[model samples]
Target: MIEILMWLAVPYIVIGLVFSVTHPDDVRSLEKQVQTQLPAGADALSFGAATLLWPMMLITGPVEEHCDVG
Candidate 1:
């Protein structure tokens, strides 16, 4: 019975590990998206802010209408 239980648990453990490491957020893609939405000739401050806030922006959704790429 113990051996049977271990076999059943192995697949679950493998899949969980795979999913845990596989996040969909790509940093470069996020930067490009930010650039598209930003105003022309915006300062480095704006770019820096977007770089810092990207994870939160992804979680909370875009603050501006044009921020959405698709």
Candidate 2:
């Protein structure tokens, strides 16, 4: 029973971790979509506030921009 339970739990654990990691950007992307519906620049301050509140600014946005290639 333990072995069978472990097998079933493994996939659930992996998918849970995947979704936990991805959930933030899902929120951010939804925010961006809402921003698009508004006039230009409306979401900029909200994003800036969120990014500033976030602890890892040094780790994220710059890397994202660099990855996008001009």
Candidate 3:
């Protein structure tokens, strides 16, 4: 049971780490959208939170809207 659970969790953890590294700005944008600021090492905290809560982050979409008004 433990092994099976570990297998199931691996994908989430790996993907979360990749996302955290690749889209760091998204994490900051999310913090801004939520209107909560953390003092010192906030980026690290945000990355950690994002890694754990990546599924919810995906559901919520990007925090910043990029509308091309041309």
Candidate 4:
């Protein structure tokens, strides 16, 4: 069970890291939507959340497009 979960998490973690690094502004924007405080390491926090919620993020599309629902 643990091995299966780890394998799943590996992809998410890798993707999350790439997204966070390449799209820091998008990650910060997401952080702003969920939290009141924008601390120094908030990017890391957002990246962690993104890893856990990758499926939702993938379904929702990019942050810019996701927010532009009018």
Q: Give the CA lDDT, 0 to 100, for residue 37 in model 1.
A: 65
TM per prediction: 0.32, 0.34, 0.66, 0.56
**Residues 2-65, model 4: lDDT tens digits:** 9999999788778877766776666666776555565676666777777666667767767777
TM-score-superior candidate, 2 or 4 = 4
User: What digit string (tens of lDDT, one per residue) describes model 2 on residues 11-47?
Assistant: 7656544543444553355355556566576456435
TM-score of candidate 4 relative to the true fold? 0.56
Please, what are the lDDT tens digits per residue for candidate 1 over residues 17-66? 44323423433344456566664533443444445454565576545434
Most accurate candidate by TM-score: 3
lDDT of each: 0.50, 0.49, 0.72, 0.69
Q: lDDT score, residue 23, model 2? A: 46
Ranking by TM-score: 3, 4, 2, 1
TM for candidate 3 is: 0.66
Position 7, candidate 1: lDDT: 100
Give the C-alpha miss distance for residue 18 in model 2, angstroms: 0.4
Rank by lDDT (best first): 3, 4, 1, 2
